[model samples]
Target chain A: MTPALDPVIHPIQRLRICALLDPVTEEEFAALRDLLETSDSALSKQLSALAGAGYASQRRATRGGRSRVWVQLTPAGRRAFHGHVAALTALANHAGDPD
Target chain B: MESDAVSAREALDAVSAARELNAERLRRPKRYWIMLGLMLAVFALLPYTADWPPLLRYSAAPALMILVAVVAAWRQPTAVRKIRLSGRMGLQLVGFALLGGVVIAVSRGVHLEQGWWWAPLVAAVLLFAFVAGVGPRMDRSWARRASHGEE
Candidate 1:
């Protein structure tokens, strides 16, 4: 079966976000922002896009009387991300092929 | 779009590199194991505190664990996101919990405290096996998965 690329995760920022979230069960929003080196609004925009596509989810909780957000990929998100990666691998493998 | 500009291979490599970087940077330090070691030491020494006040002896383990957790958290704030116990590591933990429980039950049932120091010895051995053996191996396996884009 062929793996299809997911347009939702095609952007570099979203792709990197998915890659980071792929291994972890959950990630703090602040930590993710720091790791991605993106502004809060930029990260939020990407997260919301993924979430709207049912590709991610976020939770808000209070820690030390301060609110914190944690994000994670959904099962659909994992499938889509892996599918996209597989598609990319396939493309990469054939990129230099001689016709 | 930027995706159109970057070759598929380059994008894949970038993603893989990011994954590896995250795995390497976010992994728990040896201090995490040290905290575990300290906790085990507390448990191992608990039974020997026969002369201490009952209240202090009973509460010591939880208190020490809390302190260790706080210190470990402070020392490694990244720990809050990384160091997840999953897959083989998760199974190993379940096995450890079950075996540890059985050992405790057997130790108390047989009254080995009178002459045999089997409980502490077994605890130490299991702790060593986990820290020195299974734990690192599990981390390696998890890192491989992370780098390879495995779920």
Candidate 2:
């Protein structure tokens, strides 16, 4: 089956977010921000978009006497992200095929 | 159409770069492995405690295990990304447990029959060596596989 591109994850920042979150159980928000090299508000905005789409979730926890936010891709979000990647792969691979 | 394809290729490259970055970030520091190895070593020596008071023998290992876990969690760096264990890592852990168990059992048997009191010591050293040597490598391998979206 041809994978469909997920509208919610199509943007570059959100795509990067999903890619970063894909391998981990969960990531600290600060870590994700650093990895993406984006401002906290920018990251939070993208995360909110994902959360609204049911593709991600975040929670706050206090560890070592400091409060921090952790984020993870929901199962639905993972499926959507994979599908988007597959669709992109298909599109890219089609470039070399005979017209 | 050609432009679309080019953009898609670029997007794919971005995905690859992101995954690579995540893989690099997922590596645990050497300290984590050292602590883990020490914990395993202690667990390896648990069999030698069998002759102690029943309360001490049974509770000590579990308590040590909990303490190590708490310390590890507390020390986890908030700036580094963490990866869930892959199937290969899980299998590696199970294999380590089985091997450790066999070694400890054999060491206990040897101590009983030959009075080789240092058998548990030998087992602990061997297990610690195995863990310290292989733990980091295994973590790196799993990080790579996981970032690349492999099982």
Candidate 3:
């Protein structure tokens, strides 16, 4: 049987974001944005979606007189991300095989 | 590319790439190994200096430790601002504590029985093994664990 993929996390941008956050405990918002090569508003929008779904969390703090935001994946998010990756791998593995 | 256009193959690639990136960032810098080597050198040599004045011999190790701490602080970032997902740091702390405790116990017991003339040589060999072999192997293992989503 094929594994079920998470539709919510199946989007390219969301998949990339989840992939990036899955490894680190937390990442700086600006760094994620730069890495994703997306604008502030766009990244915020995606983060908002993930937050709404309880897949990610964010915190704001002031450092060196500058406010910074950091983002991290929740436990639920990690499980979901790993599961999605597993599904992806399963799909890729079967890409050339007969049913 | 549109979200709908992304295939499972591409998603897998992205995950692999991201893991690689984090592995690189989370890796201890080369200077970290160098500092560890210097610290081990100081520790390994201290056991052999049993003939010096008690105060001077005892003070030398602490002084070197303070120097290493000061240098690490001065060179490394004060606040990394990033969360470390790997358990390597915790493992290193535990490993060092256990190793130090055992080494001190053995060296002191041997010194009481006779002269622990071979303490320094044993320590040097053990530290060489740890730094050149155990350390990198542990790092790679932890990095693999971290990359696999095991925090």
| lDDT, candidate 2, A1-99, per-residue tens | 778778899998999999999999898899889888899999999999999999999999997799999999999999999999999999888887997
On TM-score, the candidate that comes out on top is 2
2 or 3, greater by lDDT: 2
DockQ measured for candidate 3: 0.44
| Interface RMSD (Å), every candidate | 3.9, 1.2, 4.8
Error of 3 at B147 (Å): 0.7
Q: Enumerate the candidates' DockQ scores in order.
A: 0.47, 0.72, 0.44
Candidate 3: residue pairs that collide: none
lDDT by residue for model 1 (B1-151), tens? 3343256877787797778877786555666666665576555545555568999888877898899878977845544435445566677668766665665455444445465556666655565455645555655666666556544
Per-residue C-alpha lDDT of model 2 across residues B1-151, encoded as one tens digit per residue? 7897887888888899999887787877776776777787787787678779999999998898778767766856532446777777789879877887888788878987988889888988887787778878987887899999888
- The lDDT of each candidate is 0.74, 0.85, 0.74
List pairs with backbone clashes in candidate 1.
none
Question: Could you tell me the fnat of model 3?
Answer: 0.71
What would the per-residue lDDT of candidate 3 be over residues A14-68, giving only the tens digit for each residue? 8889988876788889989988899999999999988888999999999789999
- Provide the interface RMSD of candidate 1 in angstroms, 1 decimal place: 3.9
Give RMSD to native, each candidate. 3.6, 3.1, 4.5
Give the CA lDDT, 0 to 100, for residue B125 in model 1: 58
Clashing residue pairs, backbone N/CA/C < 3 A, model 2: none
- Kindly give the stretch of ten consecutive residues in candidate 2 chain B with the minimal lDDT sum: B75-84
Q: Candidate 3 chain A, which ten residues in sequence have the lowest lDDT sum?
A: A90-99
| DockQ score for candidate 1 | 0.47
